[model samples]
Target: MSEAVRPGAPRAVPYLRQPAFWIVIVLLVVGAVRIAQIAALFFGSFPLATLTAIVMFGLFAVPFWLLLAELDFLEREPAGLRVLAFAWGGLVATSVSIPGSTALDNLIAKLGSPDLAAEWGAALAGPTVEEIAKTLGVVAIVLIARTQVNSVLDGIVYGALVGLGFQIVENVVFAIGAVQQAGLGDRVQPVITTFLVRGFLAGIWSHTLFGALAGAGIGYLVVRRERSRRRRVAVAGLALFGAWASHSLWNSPILRDSFGDSVPAVLAILLLKGLPPLLLVLYLVRRAHDREAAYYVGILATVRDPGLITESELRALGSGSRRGAARRHAAASAGREAKLAVRRLQRAQAGLAVELSRGSDGAGACADRVRRHRATLAALGYPEAVEGARSWRHTASTVGTAALALAVLWVALSALGTA
Candidate 1:
């Protein structure tokens, strides 16, 4: 994506030349080496445990990935960048954070009383050390391809990936920790139980959420370039603090004492503890999406386009489910080709809107894509359902799948806890 400019604006930084690009390459290289070593140990100790972690994290991560895709429904970030964001989270952030956090915790233990160290060590160091590491992942990506991150939504998406990277690795580490107590029973039991709790129960509110909040701040700084630098810096600082506070609260042992030792009690306590920040972040995400959609929708409306993006397309583009319905409706009546064409058309139009909004040089290419898609759809007969709401089948399928997942997780956790 070439940088869009006014008649004589300064050239945008090419993706390759950006320092952030090299920084990501370096971090990924280092992190890959570190993670491979850990994976070897995990496999050596227990093969099933290693596989379980991978599978569970993948399953747990799908919802998040899907949500991020929805958030970027209009102008999707490059797949390469999104993957790198996840790698930064799972690989780069985790590889560096663990050691850095340990060292800081050790230092705190030496200077402070053992009780104080035990109680507050994580709360203090996690916000300072870990958040910085994860937030940097978001910052680095933004810096590398500054134009790629056009809004707060992009920031949250990248930030969540960084956090997810940390969360998955941390969950695996926790599962691996169960290895030390192998003599207690089946070694795999601890791994399974940990996955159930961390991956299924508390995964959403963990690192993924934290990184998102901080990333949004970074993104705000990028998009609102006209805003005073000091104000932007303050937003970034507050975002980091919000991420840190949530992390500290999650890590803090204070909740353990407040809740009973039962499974239900523990789950309730965890939800209560995690909900505030999660809700706050969710609200922010919704607002970001709305604001971004408005900007792009306005662009589509203003630009010299007649049939490129219709009002119906604009409305459908605003919601993920609607997009699915439109595509599905096309597929149902027309055929596979029609569905594909519809998707491509929407993508092109959305990309065009994004390019126009950002004043990027790639708008022409996007326009070409729209033209191709339009020809294909016209050939196949544009089959579309214009009604606003999603079908009953779609709604049921989504809700039922969620219900089943929660049920299975609860059953597995309860059984494992007893065993």
Candidate 2:
């Protein structure tokens, strides 16, 4: 997970020497203590409901963790850093936002009429406090590990993990509130209903997406050093504003009054509010990924050693689909072992590219790892690269997955009722 420093990239500071590191550690400890106290109260009040919410949201994080981990496959963020980002989100941001958002909402009520605050308080206050808290999680990462925050993709990865942490913890808190509001005597039904609404319906484009948008801004601010400092700060501000605006729109009451609360209406509202930011973040991610892929692939091309990385394999490594296709092709032509070997070879080649980018000799440890994997592939009689094809089986699987997802959505909607 070591990254190459670009010409004029900021020098790394030891974490122990950085005052910001100590500040972050203190905040995390305070947050953990606050969360533990809240958990104790929840357990005392509704043990079964609290446990159910915890378990459900804990499981909800698995796919998100896996998906975000792969976002920067070429140069994966260190596992420790990833955990740190998530912890900041779940602990520091969530704990701070609970009280901060409430206080801001109260302030809104004082400044404006009660009607204004009642209708617009959440839209105004929640995003202001929560987005700032969550965005700071990304800033904290940058302060702690400047070297790891080299690319915009790194920012997106860290931001999304922070958002995921916030989203999960916030959802758990909401689930518990649902139980209390329902007056159902510690029943799990309210928790399940909350999960269906928050986790199933609005999960994708919620906090994680917002965090990523803000993270992109921070990434741009830090990595685009060639730009004027004023311009970089402006871009970062715009990005944070974008994140806040998106979150505010989601919390606003504009659609609720106009569209009613039927299942279809709810779905439409979610899409209307969520789609723009989702599409924007997707475009940013695609652009960032392509740029990074080109840079890494260019580094590998200089070696000109088929034993290390053939031209075709080099091409495949730059693409997500082609990389998967290479492995699938290996499985079809050779055995499963060949498929695994191809994957290992691709990873090893990526490592070598990283090593080369850092001005290391081609004969270093990364190169040795590449040679070992290449030899393993040759032993399986599949040393050369393979191309991907669109097979009938692939098409069928794609269609089947879509069908299953739609079915689940329908069931969830029905279970929750139309209004």
Q: What TM-scores do the predictions have? A: 0.85, 0.94
Give stretches of model 1 more than 4 Å off.
1-13, 184-186, 303-306, 328-341, 358-365, 375-385, 389-409
Clashing pairs in 2: none
The predictions' CA RMSDs to the true structure, in order, are 3.9, 2.8
lDDT of 2 by residue, 275-310 (tens): 899999999888877878888888888899888888
lDDT of all the models against the reference?
Answer: 0.77, 0.86
**Candidate 1 lDDT over residue span 1-419, tens digit each:** 21111111113547787776887888899999998998898788777777877777777778888777667777676777788888887788788878888888888989987787788988887667889989988888877777678778889889988888788888888887775567553256777778777877788788899999999888887777677999989998999999999989888886786767676767677777788999999888888777777777777877655457676777787666677788888877787888888888887887787677667777788788887788788777773323335578878998999889767756765775687
| Candidate 2 C-alpha error for residue 295, in Å | 0.6
For candidate 1, the TM-score is 0.85
Highest lDDT among the candidates is held by which one?
2
Q: What is the lDDT of residue 134 in candidate 2?
A: 91
